[model samples]
Target chain A: MSHATRRNILKTGIFFACCGVPHTRAALAWSMSADPLPVKQVADGVFAFAGAPAMMTRQNEGEICNVGFIIGDDSVAVIDSGGSVVEGKALIGAIRAKTDRPVRYLINTHMHPDHLFGNAAFKSSGATVVGHHNLPRALESRGTYYLQSYREAMGDDLMADIRIVPPTKLITDEEDLDIGNRKLTLRAWKAAHTDNDLSVFDHKTGVLFTGDLCFIDHLPTIDGSLLGWIAQLDILNGIKAKFAVPGHGAVPSPWPQALEAERRYFDVLASDIRRAIADGVPMTNAVKSAAQRERANWKLFDEYNQRNAIAAFAELEWE
Target chain B: MFATIQLRNPLVAVVLFAFFGSAISSSAWAQNADSPESTTWSSLKGDVFGQKFIEPANGIVSIEAPKRAEDAAIVPIDLHFKTDAASGRIKTVTLIVDENPSPVAAVFRFGVDAGVTHLATRLRVNAYSYVRAIAETEDGKLRMTETFVKASGGCSAPAMKNSDEALANLGKMKLRVFSSKSSGMEPMTRATEMQLMIRHPNNSGLQMDQVTRYYIPAHFIQGLIVSQGNRLIMSMEGGISISEDPNFRFEFDAKPGEDVKVEASDTEGKKFQDEWPLASSSL
Candidate 1:
């Protein structure tokens, strides 16, 4: 049997009950619904939805990340699925309202739960899942952990239908897919935002779906390599795209300009951490004030900045 | 009764045991707030210390961990040790993460005359748990101190950020020496601070394969010894709970010209050894 099918069976099997209660409620109290996420026409034949700048919860139905679709003459290609199956269904609803074209491809920008938990919702759409070549391995290591940990915040009801689905079509470097007359180019990147970051460039409209690579208002998280991300900035900027749809923040941001805030944040964090390392400061103490100067500029600064600093400090200490 | 339940259906019994553990940790501690007689500690004391009378840490030793871990996989834990006329000197210290799979994170033994004062390290906390430090002083008394940490959803935060890179540079070591900043340093042997970094994945092996779905076997550094010219400074018997690239920052008395050496061996039997010369007047 295929991996997805096997996992699907286990998800509903008797052993699942052995894992115990689905979840116990935490502090946050948000009433969530599975309404179709609102989307906007970012460019010609491109529609994107800007998710909330908050942690994924049942109230938001895990709609805390940008997910959208590109409509070609023959079919539609999705950029990412939201954080929950409910949000994923809402995304499909938004797609159906836009065009009657068949959903041919569901491209995951990365392996983060906010972007891929909705993969199960696209099963009936007959969309062949696509992602970075490293997506499967990354999912294998972290998929179970995501399922177990998110259950507490997302609750049992919303998490019931969530399943980890790996991509069938993997992007090694760059590959182009044709949907009628439109040519969409998919480029797989190194370890930056994640090890399996894949960005899609809609050739005809000049709209680049820079998934997680470019965070605008939301603070960029560092789960991959800090030095690798900094080294690839010039290469990411070299992509010739007029408009860009980031993984989070403004649905349709201006190209290259959208990269400024995150780049500066990384620079400030790296320099401060380097100074701390040079001064022989401990990781715990150094991360406390790594990027405190940028506190006023971004949303969810307190939620993710220190976490980013901790990861960056560990990575940069090897330098 | 416990053995009967285990024999009936090991899987179900295991699940129920885990369920009750979490429930006890969540509810009992929530209401009482780190009572000395909590069920987890009550039962753990017998299993670890074997009915010995344990005393509260009235300033003999202290543990500091983040109240809320930002990243669960690398929660920083700092331990400070003090020796007075009453409690002579600390000989060994055991670190435990109450709610982790392998609760006994590490057993660290210190040299009798090392005069180690402060030790800092990192750990992987799996749930909302209590991180405890049990110190065995020269008088053979057990003194314990613990801190409650609120961390959840760490499963997404795998210890290994770049797994391939972590494997590629396995066994790499770096030793950094910091200038002593504290007063009251022994005139003959000045107090010194040093940080040791080792590159290893320290994988928990709880992750399942994408294809076969079988869990990857646990692999981690099992033993570590740090010495200054044959006089042992510290040694650790560690488990999977240690974070990837195990990092340790510590302060101890230095004999000036002796070479500091580190020897570590992992589960795979791969041994790593490195040494650095200590300057005669290391500030």
Candidate 2:
């Protein structure tokens, strides 16, 4: 093992001992009889489990990441997992209720906690976990922090079974997974929502899983590069798909058009920040006025817009 | 006999006061809606500066901090000092975050040759507090200015950089001096402006370790001393309010080729020292 991986393992060991929580492997197994998660059949053989459109809270149990599963003639290919072990178990139950076939692959579209924390629920299912090549590094750096924050935000009862589960198979550029009779195309993009963002395309159903990349109603968070995200949107718009499933908000949004609102928000943010920099406006003033034009268009504008502006200014100021 | 009678009549006094006192307090609260429950600047000045006389700085000393911080952990604050109205030289500047765990964030002492002071640095404001800047003149007169910042949880916010990555390059220091006269096209002039940055995590005790899931012990730069040829220019006592990589920018009068020395110590009692030769010109 690499030295960093070894160190991370040691840290994980220490973390488990310190928190007094059981290792993920010792947790409960995935059962077909568990309560099934509610899902909508967005297309033939494609099921989407839409989560609450609000921020994570104790009431929602961090179930704010949309998850889906693509069933083929013989097996199932699970898209992004839910936010918690309960949600993951519910997803497994939902899959079992629809098809008795074994899960062939578990794909994580990104390394965000809301999309990957539920991987522990499918650990016993004998399905290989897959994600972008940078996902493991991102997880190693941020997993512990996210876990603690969620525990404090949602409490121990709600976050009890959640664990940072890294993917076993890494996708660098693109890969196609064959699940019996279906082929799922997975593409990993440049630093956008995060450095490890990925998307999945179901060839049979023409449904695209744009995890956290396409937000319908929610204000897009700028954790990665603003410029990179805008560039990725250009590429995402060109993909041919009948419907798109976003990481958050409503599923099965019309392709290409679903990306407009988010694209506009990012475009305005970049332009405004560039103008602020050119005008020699200070960071404090830029935070308030950079993205004021889009204030009425997005939810949580007050909470995240200033932060986005600040991040953009910091990045663009040096350029 | 009089004490006993007074004690016995306590119930009558309580009955009479309750009817009149409660009504007056409610009306007083309604009138002061804008000013919240926190202690006012006048009281904070007394508590922090003690009996020291403070004169209002009529735009002589100004503080620029975000009215509403984007990131509470790293709120950039700029302090400018113009010697136009001052009777004497600027000696010391103290930064105070009135509501932080440790209100006295830093105290900066300047040498006689320190030119028109313009300082820009980052601070971590723990709560919604008035960030006050107090400057003491060479004649022992003090002038103060303050700005109300709306931010919270800065001290507890996790460090943006990973702990291991931060620790790997601990104590690495960088010094860049910018001279106003050297606009790249102009000839060399007396270089005065300097920006010194020290690499330290400055972890607050509030942030939990992402891996171990425990409060990462607070380890920050506790003391910083800057000197020019053994002459003490400035020294700062920092707390959680200082950002991870403690950075300071100010203008001081120093001759070209003079060695600018810096020494800092962290909470763990480790000492780091670095020295840079001031460049005569920017070209």
Measured against the native two-chain assembly using Cα atoms, what DockQ does each of the candidate structures obtain, in the order listed? 0.24, 0.06
Instruction: Enumerate residue pairs that collide in model 1.
Output: A32-A59
Per-residue lDDT of model 2, residues B59-146, tens digit only: 6679998765556556889999876544577778889876655567788877666564777788876544678899888777888888
Off by over 4 Å in 1: A1-35, B1-29, B32-38, B152-156, B182-187, B210-213
TM-score of each: 0.87, 0.62
Model 1 over residues B168-228: C-alpha lDDT tens digits?
Answer: 9999999999987775666456778999999999998877676697888888999999999
**Winning model by TM-score:** 1
Which lDDT tens digits does candidate 1 get at residues A1-319? 1322432354324223432322112101111222335577787789888888778776666778899999999999998988988778767766665567888999999988899999998887789999998888888777866876676567667788999999999999999999889999999988898888999999999999999999988888888788888888889899999989999889789988888888899999999999999998899899999999999999878778888888888888999
> Positional deviation of B227 in candidate 2, in angstroms?
13
Query: Alpha carbon lDDT of residue A69, candidate 2?
Result: 96
- DockQ of prediction 2: 0.06
Weakest ten-residue segment in model 2 chain A by summed lDDT: A19-28
Tens-digit lDDT track of model 2 for A218-292: 777766567778877889999999989998778789998999999889888888999976664556667788879
Model 2: lDDT of residue B208: 47
